[model samples]
Target: DVKVTQSSRYLVKRTGEKVFLECVQDMDHENMFWYRQDPGLGLRLIYFSYDVKMKEKGDIPEGYSVSREKKERFSLILESASTNQTSMYLCASTLPAGLAGAETQYFGPGTRLLVL
Candidate 1:
């Protein structure tokens, strides 16, 4: 079975603190993504990696960065926490598009971050 895991389900951080949100997938998928959803703003893609050690910046990569040191693991880092940055962060993995199997993504439970 395919499983995606995040380091934390919920996180509370003070302003200016560095925060790390980690994600891992059991399947050896080629693509991993990080996204943040805010009220009214909807889902915004932050970053993604198509291959191991290869990373790409997504729609909003201003305050967020990512790492894919291993095939199963991807880490999202918050340079400095802020109230404006508080949102539900999500991680997902998918098979390469247009493959034999479904290209639908399997997502982690998500990390809800609150900056105080």
Candidate 2:
């Protein structure tokens, strides 16, 4: 089965601290994504990479960035963790181009962050 794993299932950080959230997929999928889920707001994309070394900013990429040095791994970086950044972050991957479907994504369990 296609699986995506996140670096942490839970994280606690102080305000202004830089945080790194890592994700790895074993399915060799070409598309990887990062999103933050807040209560009632649903999932908001942070960044996504379509190909190795290529990345694109998503809807809510304001205080975040991403890196994709390898095809199976994608990393999300929080420049400065703020209280407002406290949310459940999800890492997901999908089949290569031309394969995305309504049920395309394979998501990690999620990493919940608490920024104090």
Please provide TM-scores, in order, for all candidate models, with all chains considered together: 0.94, 0.94
Cα displacement (Å) at residue 43, model 1 = 1.2
**Residue-level lDDT for 27 in candidate 1:** 94
Candidate 1, residue 28: the lDDT equals: 94
Candidate 1 similarity to native, TM-score? 0.94
- Candidate 1 lDDT tens digits, 1-116: 89999999999999999999999999999999999999898889999999989999999999888889999999999999889999999999998988477588999999999999
Candidate 2 lDDT:
0.93
Model 2 lDDT per residue over 1-116, tens place:
88889999999999999999999999988899999999999999999998999999999999998999999999999999999999999999987656454447899999999999
Q: Candidate 1 lDDT (Cα, whole model)?
A: 0.93
The candidate that wins on TM-score is 2
